[model samples]
Target: MKTLDFKPKLVSAIRNYNKQTFMADLMAGLIVGIVALPLAIAFGIASGVSPEKGIITAIVAGFAISALGGSKVQIGGPTGAFIVIVAGIINQYGIQGLTIATLMAGVFLIGFGLLRLGTIIKYIPYPIIVGFTSGIAVTIFTTQVKDLLGMQMDAVPSDFIEKWIAYFQNLTHIDPWSAGVGLVSVAIIASAPKFSKRIPGSLIAIIVMTVVVLLLKQYAGVTSIETIGDRFNISSQLPDAVVPELSWETIKGLVAPALTIAILGAIESLLSATVADGVIGDHHNSNTELIGQGVANIVSPIFGGIPATGAIARTMTNINNGGRTPIAGIVHAVVLLLIFLFLMPLAQYIPMACLAGVLVVVSYGMSGWRSFTALMHNPKSDITVLLLTFFLTIIFDLTVAIEVGIVCACLLFMKRMSETTDVKAVYDEIDLNEDADMERGNLEHLSIPKGVEVYEINGPYFFGAGNKFEDLMGGFGDRPKVRIIRMRKVPFIDSTGLHNLENMCLMSQKEGITVVLSGVNEKVEAVLRRNNFHKLLGQENICNHIDLALARANEIVG
Candidate 1:
């Protein structure tokens, strides 16, 4: 493994930086910043945080990621992925708890990078990713329903079923003005790409809805619609950095939640880097990317930010706008900083329902309904994992869903591997021509000696296949003077296999039979020698070929 590599992409990107590249980066960064603005505010409000916190993250974390990241065009900021978990932490343990958890997660991310576990992200099961992602999308949509329709209610319940019940109970209190703004915003967002691809539909929806709602509220006296200012006191300046109130007790309590954040952040950032690599035909150093994310998460929370990661949407926006370097990401941060400092109070005018409409669209895109439906036709085991994760995420939580889903997937994998392992008895005569492992010009046939039995094992001898081997050995008919066990096809042996082999050897000795192991590869022979298997079965009895084993077995039979 390589020692820690602290190199960031920005270091190399600057070597060839020129006026033309800067111009291109400037255009892309400006557009992406515009696209990121509404999303930051919406995610902040939805995550039970002040709206300015989102911009702070987009500015602070966004700058850290681009300045120290591995990917050239990856745009990092607050994303929808953490909404459920962040909200849950706040609800259960308040802002301080969330802070401690975020800090712990940052340290975990750095550890992951230093340990060089970044490549492991590729091993996460696709079904599980889709399952939880779709589940999160549904959860996000549920959370936005109240704001979308302007329902008059207290806090929305955290439980999925109870939250829906609350929505039903409060349906009678829907404000038509808010509902109209939300529906129109959704319509604009859903249809805007058809007319113009360059401009973001979310930005357009926010502008149009904010203007319409403002005009209606001031002149028409339709002042019932709620806006961001009504809920969160907007801040136009960055606050002093804060040290998280962390103790050993708090760290212990927050480990699991922190692990959830680390896992989600790693997956999202690496996935975004992978996608951008495909678009730009460049390979990203995954470990470097993880470290950048670790730094971002660590710094952002100090300035009143929430958990952040690579935003695939904004990264794509950057790519489409011709951003080919980290400079674009840095410029985007600067743009958000300007907005946060000078124009944050104007954010108060943006309607809550309009933000809800934007998130509704995000939830729909995240749903991955097409992938969900396609996966239904896969193997039943995969479908089982998929559905289990999806439901668990909805009914319980994302952390539970991921854990249970991985366990189920592993069990099913072992089951399938065990099924492929073959153990069977060979009778009468063996044909060398039919044996693929033997030389083609060797002995044509070998007759079995009277009262001798031969068995072949055709796969890895792991714990999963140990019981099958035992059953086959114990179920054989007739007493045998000699037994030859073929292990040419077995690639490796586990402790369970060694234990079973020992038991078989001891049982054979008591039955007045000589046991021989045939085609024992160098590795298995070393394992047997280490276990003193040769003392139980003589060293000469372990043969390299079936012919040699048959000769020894015939000598025993005679």
Candidate 2:
């Protein structure tokens, strides 16, 4: 196998990082940081952790991924994808467990990159990807209802259906003020781009909602809803690294969650990188990006951060705002760092409902509702794979969803491929065109010889399509006096396909009948020689085309 190689272009634009680009990146970074800030906090809280973890992830993991990653504009941080996994880890094993799992996941990512499995990851079926992605979106959206509506629930269960039931049971207790803030926040953030492109709607919404809540508190003295400070005390101190306890029992328990984190992180990060490539017209080194993300996840957990990956929305904002290099990603991280140190206290006043609203939008985007519905319009095989993966993701766990989805896709693909495999009687009508030759050809007027059969396979000879060859050969009521199997149309044959050919040859030999092959492409012929099928069936029987094989068949019969 030829090894996969990529040549990195190490061109420098630092000398030309003129004031214009710098200012653009600076502002873009700031805007993305603000957008990320509330998101980081909300994601962390949703994942069953404190607010600081999310910010720390944005600062530490975000910086590491951008500084070392392959893409020029990818923004890395805790995304909506990890909410369910993180929550499960935290619920089952605690924060220490989550940290250990994150670290282990990092190791897995690095190993995957080192093993050069980057290209193989792309083979993951589209239906499976959409299925779990849509499922994750729904899960995130459901998780935020309690916070968005200001419902008083001590703990939200992890099960999907149970959580919804819990939400509806508490529907009557919704706080009207918090609901109003969430709805307004959503509107302002959603409609911000219509008014101005430079400033993000989320930041504007946060400011507007925050100031409104502040004025209400100061003037109207309304105290119905909770804020970040009331839920978890805010601190301005820089987050410190905490060493995780790596006990045998903890490692054993964290293995599954760690694998889940690693797989989902790889999927989301690569997907985001691919999306960035399209937006910027640049290709990303997937293996290098995976390694970078691994390092980020590994290091961020030590600093009290959660699992992180390349964030698509943030990366898009960076690109739209003229952030054209990795420097922008680094700047974005630094911008968040400054906010964490200086503006942490101010963030306390940003209502929890505002954060919930931001995440609501995040969930909607991540859910990819448009694409999910679009997938329904695809082929039935694709629809089956999509719905299977989606429902499995919602009902069970993501790992299971992915496992089953891939398997289902593989089975469905084999089924389709098998359907494409056809055994045809090509005498007088190979192309099936309505032109001359078929009715007037010499062979067309010739009478069929008793106990002689001819069949042509017209596609790639892979296992799925290969097995059907036996059925075609067996379709003859009795063993033919001679059989000519034409394989000129088969571009290539895999091991299983060759094995089937050998079986057909052996069966013909046992019946004291001759089997001849015609139009064998060089690749398939090479496989036959390598498998010693040529010797078993005699090289004289194998010809370059159907005409030569028919001549040889005639000689054998005479």
Candidate 3:
């Protein structure tokens, strides 16, 4: 709660009114709006919706997120993370269902913020994050291949293998012009950084390719590919509001997709905020950001927009071009809105293949190839998680991939921790050496006398490692004269571990052998006192160290 406070001084320092900062913000906003143009349309089309909704989302949700969000430079809009979820909702429940689901997700996000669970969400494991992220990248790439190559399929299949099979069936009808354009677009976007740092490669590719496509359409009479106008009617007017049906039945149907959308949106938005923090050396209020996103989502859908969140690429573009405050993001939204009203007609000529080309570049950029390669050199368990998540996301679905990946990672981590826990026995053998400093007669060695045994336990004694205690103590065939348990290195113990220890003491007493404890740390001592282990084992037998326990053990044995 304390971490969520917004410092007025920090805000004033950044929000200082100046012509230089305002001009810089305006230019950055314009540039990011251009970068977002193709992506907005492509993401909408890819989600099986018309192009205008994506633009509206960028205008409405993007504006609200920046104006009211926690991060200063986060550029918000429709993101790839929401692609799988929105598509799934549209397929199962239709456009109306998708809207309702987005609204529900927004409400959930608002609740999440109010509960102040923002910081805790960071505890999600790194392997799980990478696994799902890489998986989504692969899926986005796979989904765009058909459009990029201009494959002549009536409807693209959603299943992974089936999608490829459909693509192969249409391989013979591939449009050379479209593929050439996509390849060119990829090349230009890929090489943008080498030549110019201010302008984005995707924006350049879109301009060049749109010109080329328009020329071919005018002179060649070769209409082999589709454009945004071909699929959906182009309209500059805001979509008419229609309330979606949301009875219990509709709510029940959309619950799963709604939850998935909420989770993905939360993760992507917060991660982008963190990245912006690293770039500008400032902190963000994650809970407040989430609440802002929720409000934007709730309102955007009513205006016929899709699920939206902070986009990493757009946010980075904002920072690189001198955007340093939330004002720049608001300016970006306004710029996009102005374009929608006055320039939407011109967008009709933007070919779907060109948009596809833009998405192909997006897919490539999202791949995180270096990070993927680095994970290959990680531990086997992590590698397994990476592969499992990647394959599951491609072959099955994103939701299942995340759920199973998290579970598998947790179980594997516990197994590794358990393996590091052990018990060992030690004997003082140095005194037997001839080079001992003490005289042979005077030199003394501690030994495990007959009918008495000792053991040392090390590491955390959680439920997983606690079972080993039974195995070690069970080795005694029957009650011995005395037994000592050492736990100097045991820093922590839980209820289950204490339960096992209590049972061990009871069994030893039942077998007529007194059990002694040695070398307990303050943490373990607290548990011992709370669980009454000292009372059960006897205070006299609970010695401070091994030597004391050994002496007491010898007396009992004698």
Candidate 4:
């Protein structure tokens, strides 16, 4: 069994802590915290929770992820990706359901880490990931249209098509003042990057738009514009812990969504860690990263927050701003906590349309349109999976898209594996120099007996290829007296492959045909010994070369 990787990067980073590193971390943390503020608020509101809850998540979950994560500069908080699922859960099962689901997801993440399945997760089909992420961006963009345009509607339907139709119906009811504020907010955020890299665009958009909205509402008598204060009762202090009532029924109902959260969290956190690793020239412990994320998710929701994961954008910001340790992340959490305790009430002045505008940019970033378009030029099968996952996420739900996408990817993988492994019969040739075994090189050619046949397997003998090989074996009619099976190129044999080989041995025995194994690799031979195939086929008949196998076959033939 593998040892648990529970060590956090903070522990390792602190061993070499210095004043210079501390100052650098402080600066980066301060900047990242400022960057996280508007995003947290926007992600919070978009996720169907209050703005304060988003801040609370940034403080609490952000701290946990940084303090306990394996990566040096990973920043954890509420992100735009969770908006769809969190909102959907709230819409269906209520707040308690979201809470329980987050808790369950945390448990699942911990289990995944403890099981040491991190490397496996990193290999999940890339196309499926792109598809899901792109679809999420589209869904997020769709959700923001109402807020972005200031549509006068009671409630936006959750279904994708229904929501768009309602938007069309409400097009004539657009609040011009709100629309003006939203459009201006979007323009500012979209263009602010050219002004200064030191400041975040979303923050500038909020400050500028908040002042404009306030001035218009106060002096110009424009009462149509909406702000955070008008929507949610913004809180200044950390809220009391919320204990959700859990029942078996609730657990059963939330399992699917909870699993989705676990998968998303694992994929995102590890991807962020991997990206940070490339830039930092350091490797992150994936298991430790996952456990840290699990801890964050489990704790944040108790404080009335939603699911939390490592934010890639903020992480890159930390790197770009000279953050080289977990200290920066911890400091960022402290910064957010201070804001939560003191400056949270000011968030009420932040316009909801500005947040919608912030998210509008966010959605566009996550769209991965360049990658999506590039993938369109890939293999037809990849394109099929991409489009399927994309449409399913928009039309139905993320849960459905992920599950179906994974299944299809697996099936396609197996199909490709089976196509690559081939079993060929070489009955006429006997070239000793052409032998695969290097140990038996530079020898004379050996002739095959009249009643002997030699077959070579070219790839992995997994279940997919095993069944086809078994069928080919069954197709044989003029059975030879001596049959040589070459597996020098065979890397490993799964259970099905072993079973098929065992059955072939039994059938050959009953048909009075002597079977000789030649060039079986050490690993496959070890597997055969463990399964007692050596005992059934007789050990002498298994040879390291055709020279010995043919000699044994000649004895059997005599």
Task: Extract clashing residue pairs from model 3.
Answer: none
Better of 1 and 3 by TM-score: 1
User: If scored against the real structure, what TM-score would every candidate get?
Assistant: 0.95, 0.90, 0.88, 0.96
Top-lDDT structure, candidate number = 1
TM-score for predicted model 3 compared with the true structure? 0.88
lDDT by residue for model 1 (1-558), tens = 566766799999999899999999999999999999999999998899999998898999999999998999999999998998899899888999988888888889888888888998768889999999999999999999999999989988889999999999999999999999999999999999998888899999999999998999889999899998888788797799999766899899888889999999999999999999999999988988999999998998988899999999999999999999999999999999998888889999999999999999999999999999999999999899999999998899888888898899889888888788788888888878766655546568878888888988899877656566567765557888998998888888878889988888888899998999988898988998999999989998998878888889988888
**Per-residue lDDT for 301 in model 1?**
90
lDDT of 4: 0.89
* Model 1 regions more than 4 Å off: 434-442
RMSD of each: 1.9, 3.3, 4.2, 1.8
**Candidate 4 structure quality by residue, lDDT tens digits, 1-558:** 667768899999999899999999999999999999999999999999888889989999999999999899999999888998899899998988999999999999998899988889999898899999999999999999888888889888999999999999999989888888788888988888899787999999999999999898889998888889998987787778877888999899999999999999999999999999999999999999999999999999998889999999999999999999999999999999998888988888887788889998999999999999999999988999999999999999999999999999999888888788898777565776777673555556767787887877889887666556556664456778988888878898989888878877788889898889988889989999999988998999888876788788888878
Supply every candidate's count of residue pairs whose N, Cα or C atoms clash at under 3 angstroms: 0, 1, 0, 0
Residue runs of model 3 more than 4 Å from their true location after superposition: 1-19, 240-243, 428-452, 474-479, 528-558
Tens-digit lDDT track of model 2 for 489-523: 78888877777777777877998989898788788
- The local lDDT score (0 to 100) that residue 58 gets in candidate 1 is 93
